[model samples]
Target: MPAADAGGTPDPLRRLTLADLRRRTSMKWRTYEPDVLPLWVAEMDVPLAEPVAEALTEAVRLGDTGYPAGTVYADALRDFARHRWDWDFPASRTALVPDVMLGIVEVLKLVTGPGDAVVVNCPVYPPFYQFVRHLGRRVIEAPLDAAGRLDPAALESAFARATEGGRRAAYLLCSPHNPTGTVHTEDELADVAARAAARGVRVVADEIHAPLVLPGARHVPYLTVPGSETGFALLSASKAWNLAGLKAALAVAGSAAARELAAMPEEVGHGPSHLGVIAHTAALRHATGWLDSLLAGLDRNRRLLGELLTRLLPGVRHRPGEGTFLAWLDCRALGLGDDPAAAFLDRGRVALNSGLPFGTGGAGHVRLNLATSPEILQEAVRRMASAVPDTGRRTREDP
Candidate 1:
């Protein structure tokens, strides 16, 4: 457990140190050399909530590692959604899958056949391309606008091309989008729903980051929109509670699309670990306080990162998006060529995700993870500043 400050508020998350985090066996720590500071992966540097840990521990003690079964996980999600987002999520409309990406692939198979087109917004999650391609589907990209927000015009054009020649197609929506952390506004989502419906495109929303929405931002479920009756959404407690290793997620369908969700094969459910279901259910049902504390800590880290970037890497442009702890940085001014991430990793020993892999509009960019302690974030920025050539000349003078 984390110690408390003078205010009696526990700030355990802030107490996390590089030395302590390095001891873990996770990929984030092991992917790079010992001396390198890894801010690449989406994993956070926070301890598990007590409820989640307890549930996992209890499951282990009872040797409950059999195959996953039942609807407890979906029910918990229902309760949590009702209270947190004011949305009535029907448990009957959901199916359990190993994870969000897999659930999306399964849903896509139901809606479209092999070689059908699947649309994505690039400078988007790299996996959106990988998994869709693995399923033998053609990936059509609708790039985000200059400010990293959804552009309805771009989407409309992509939908037209994707649905041409009477071809079957599906749109993979990443709400509270990855890499850029852009939270889709209600108006924007409604527009998307309307556009997709008009083009005969089925929408599958990846809302794994829905729970991680910070203050001043709202996460509106796509199915809740007026014209989204035919859409499906993939959700999980993994991102918000740092339970990615759990391998559990809910594939939810709109009332009119329930049959598609029900058609998902039973073998898909077998992929989720039994313990993962227990932990995720506990997280959604009994871990709101922990989630709240994490949101507050992330809010601090986001602001602190901006200050660090402004002072240390003035040539790099970053506008903190409305949700998620990922910061998409534009490093074109630094002249790091096509891949700035490589330069940062090679020179600064900071491993960030290369924006090149995210596709068009990704060159000269890097995505930095902002889920660590302020101290670590500060060190990362400092090391990054040192990595750039003529850093002293590029920095902005303090007012």
Candidate 2:
């Protein structure tokens, strides 16, 4: 258990200096102005750990920047899986993917065809709907329950209906779920696995946010379910380690169906970047303390954000996060009419991920990232409160 400094100071292990973040933002956000606080993207403001940075810097200096070939990152990934999830994944069996979305695209191509239906839980990662439509596959949404938790009964019912309808439906599972931060329990995952297995449906579990789960909340890999050896798992430290620029991810599949679906025979040129492999390996092998610190920082940030919102704006309700640093806020109480995100941006000058894009159920909502510093989180909440009139007085403790 790595810990952060009290009073919201950056932990030395997970220190992401403001200077490096400033430099990185100039190129990435295009709004390099020092005033803007960027919480829109999944990337965190934290600096890379010393070990991870040193590994990449050393690899670059050694002139190791060539086409990746062989087990540079494989062993590190195996060790990471073993230590973090207690799951054994043979290094030899894992496939290197340039990006997680690319792997999802590849799997979609293999499992479904034009007019085939691909089922997704609503208010999901935008890519879940985008990928299926990109490949001419019909997107079928099985929405999460009112509690914002994935409903196993709804999922099972949907699968049975799809099976009866003769439509080939593949499920995309997001754990420690993005945008909402709900961590699926083992029993929930087991039920999903059982449903998919019984219905002859393939499940693509996106466990990218697994590393950010809070202390008490656990993220169960879809493959850990009994008889789920064949389930496909798309995992990467890119989200956890904020290595999105490196463009590296892992695709895990032990079952014959998963293997057959994930394998891309035509794309010989697509492989992991040397820097990505080096950074990933280093982070997995040596950056455990740093990661733990980040998880703690994120958890604290989540609490602080909630407190700020509850004190300042009563109508905007949010359920405390179970995982991930993102929180889904119900802004319907504020009569912003439609597109509350746009109204907030116009009045609050803060850019939040709009809920409508997630699905109909997500309307009148906004997704905020609490992964940044306490200062930034407080400022965002202040701006949001100011944007909307404080008519009601409700605090987190009131309920």
- Quote model 2's TM-score: 0.91
RMSD of 2: 3.2
* lDDT of candidate 1 over 1-399, digit per residue (tens): 554434444554686778899998999999889999999899999888889999999999999999998899999999898988888877889999999999999999999998999999988999999999999999999999998989888999999999999999999999989989989988999999999999999999999999988889999988888899999999999989888888899999998899988988989999998988999999999888777877777888888888887777888888897898899999988878889888888999999999998989999999999888878889999998888888432844534
Model 2 CA lDDT for position 150? 89
Candidate 2: regions farther than 4 A off: 1-20, 26-28, 31-35, 258-262, 266-271, 392-399
| Number of the top lDDT candidate | 1
lDDT of each: 0.89, 0.75
Clashes of each: 0, 2
Give per-model TM-scores.
Answer: 0.96, 0.91
Task: Report the CA-based lDDT of candidate 1 relative to the real structure.
Answer: 0.89
Residue 308 local lDDT, model 2: 85
- What lDDT tens digits, residue by residue, belong to model 2 across residues 220-262? 7777778676577877888778788886777778556555743
